[model samples]
Target chain A: MAKLTMTVNGRTLSADAEGRTLLSDFLRGGLGLTGTHVGCDTSQCGACVVHVDGQAVKSCSMLAHEAAGSTITTIEGMANADGSLSTLQQAFQDHHGLQCGFCTPGMVMSAAALLAENPKPTEAEVRHHLEGNICRCTGYHNIVKAVLAASGQDVSGVGIAAE
Target chain B: MYAFDFVKPGTLAEASEALSHDGALPLAGGQTLIAAMKQRLNAPEKLVSLTGIPELKGVCAGDGGVTIGAATTHAAVAAQAAAYYPALAALAGQIGDPAVRNRGTIGGSLANNDPAACYPSAVLASGATIVTNTREIAADDFFQGMFTTALHDGEIITSVKFPVPQKAAYAKFQQPASRFALTGVFVAKFADGVRVAVTGASESGVFRWTEAEAALTANFSAAALDGLSVPADGMIGDLHGTPEYRAHLVKVMTKRAVVAAG
Candidate 1:
């Protein structure tokens, strides 16, 4: 076992984890931060997306030991300080970005990362950025709407559900 | 994943020393290695993490070309390599997805040498050099076959140096599910001649389209590739696509790349 420390959300957490412990497993099992869902055991599914050292990555594809000393942000940490929904989360609700919601955490995390980098992405850019995040529900139309709305773009004619 | 001992080496020498041990593998980004481990495809006794080595994590552009550290992530290369090597940057940007791009490194991609990987086409077309702790191998000499390289055991790659070409562009037809190239073509035009590397199509792995290169070297235009066709015998045939389909994509993507470069 390797002893590792890292900043999760805003809190510094340290734990003794096995070398085979995945970041997703570490988050879900070790710390009980189940917000970072692991939908696909294979790295192809983006349900395990999280931010490590400010860059979005698939948590399932990285080991806990590899993420040592890094800062990570999962879906659980995206809420407002006052414990309310963040703008992106609120937008997802307003736009019906999810149905079953298994992929929402990863979707929101991936979109948040995109908006952080490119605040004004086009419709095509938003879709392209979501290539890794697969929604089995096939609710991509609304998800795109939610991301565009979060970016403060005009999503009126972009097939967003009426508020 | 199998039980393995993990060691984060602070320097390249230390990492190399660790790799000299039996059943030791250098871990970069952990994008491919970790996935393979989980699937029971690979099980090494020791994983020497290269992320801690500052010497192997950056991009440097100079007179001849761009030198990218082996540990430099794809996202870093995509964002930083635009000025010196736009084609390289564009290709890097299109690899996998945002999440995969964030952690996947150039060295890992080249070392893995997946038939559909984007980096090999860039390296081959640009005539890059794979620099290792021991010696520098030309791109032509570096890649041997499918998932194979000339890298000796315990010889870790330090960086890759790509000589800037006058005009170059890469175009890929993604396989939707994995986002890997169904067939990708990279075209680089230098003062002397043209180089075209086709990936995701060849059975033997990434190979230069000599016919297309000669055709474009004489006349650097999409129209120059007019009746040229690649045989399907040496191409990959799988559930994703037939060998003939991949061969056809090679020509289509090459034309698209040349047109984009023009």
Candidate 2:
């Protein structure tokens, strides 16, 4: 066991964990931050994506012990200081991008990472970047629309616009 | 995953010392290792993480090529090696996905030597040098078979020195589900000759297509491969694809790679 220290969602925190504990388990099971979901724990389904040191990574694919001393941000951190949804989260609502909504956390995290690197990604680029994330509800086109809308692009020409 | 002792060493010596112990596995990226552990398929007594060692991460361009540190993630290679070797960098860019690329390392990919991996094709086709703590091994001598390599248990790859080709490109037919190479081809055209390496198709792991090399060396064009085809018996036949299907992809991807290289 180890006492690992990391800054999560702007708060410096410590968690007692074993070497076998995954970052997802550390967040959900240990820290009780259940926003970081784990759909397919094998890393295929990107439901557990989170920002590690400002770069997105699959939480399940990493060990909490490996992430010690780094800064992290889960879905719980994607809100404004006033506790309202961020632009990306709002876009997901406007576009009706989610069906069951299980994949929303990872999709939001991945979109944030993409915009951080390529702020003005094309529609095709948005779809390509979201390939890691799987939403079985066929909520893809709307999700792509949401990502583009979140980037402040004129997304009216793509996907179903809000009524 | 089973309970295990995890140690992230700050130096290569410490990592090597930790790995020398019984049932001690050196974890580079933990992208593949961690997933395997979740299924209880891999239960190591201890894991010595090599990523924290500064000496094992970065891309240094020299000798008319690029040397990528073992612990350097695919994301780093895609960003750093772009100016030096665009073809290799492009290959690194499309591997897995945004999250997986951020965690998976070149050294871990080459060391694991998965039959469907992308790095082995690039390394074998570029004729890169796999540098470890003890010695440097040629790419030809490094990869043994699927999930096998020439490295000793305690040995860890420090970096890979790739001799950048004048014209080189990789074309992968991705397994839609995993995004891994279903049967990828990497073609490199040097001043003297051409080298072709195929991955994801062969059951014996990555192997060079000498016939394709000879033909492409004579004429560095896609037309030169018009009549080439590999035997299906040696290809991997899984639920994703049949042996015959993989064999066909090898030829098709090779041609596409040659054209892309041109």
TM-scores of the candidates in the order shown: 0.98, 0.98
lDDT of each: 0.92, 0.93
Q: What is the per-residue lDDT of model 1 for residues B1-262, given as tens digits with 9 covering 90 to 100?
A: 8999998989999999999998999899888889899888999999899888999988888977999999999999999999889999999999999999988999989889998999999999999999999999999998888999999877788999999999999999999888899999999999999999999999888999999999999999999998899989989999999999999999999999999997
- In model 2, what is the error at residue A22, expressed in angstroms? 0.4
**Model 2 chain B worst lDDT run, 10 consecutive residues:** B30-39
TM-score of model 2 vs. true structure: 0.98
Each predicted complex: what DockQ? 0.88, 0.88
Give one digit per residue, the lDDT tens place, for model 2 in A61-98. 99999899999999999999999999999999988889
CAPRI rating of model 1: high
Residue-level lDDT of model 2, residues B49-114, one tens digit each, is 988999999999987999999999999999999999999999999899999999999999998999
Candidate that would win on lDDT: 2
Off by over 4 Å in 2: A160-163
Q: Which pairs clash inside model 2?
A: none
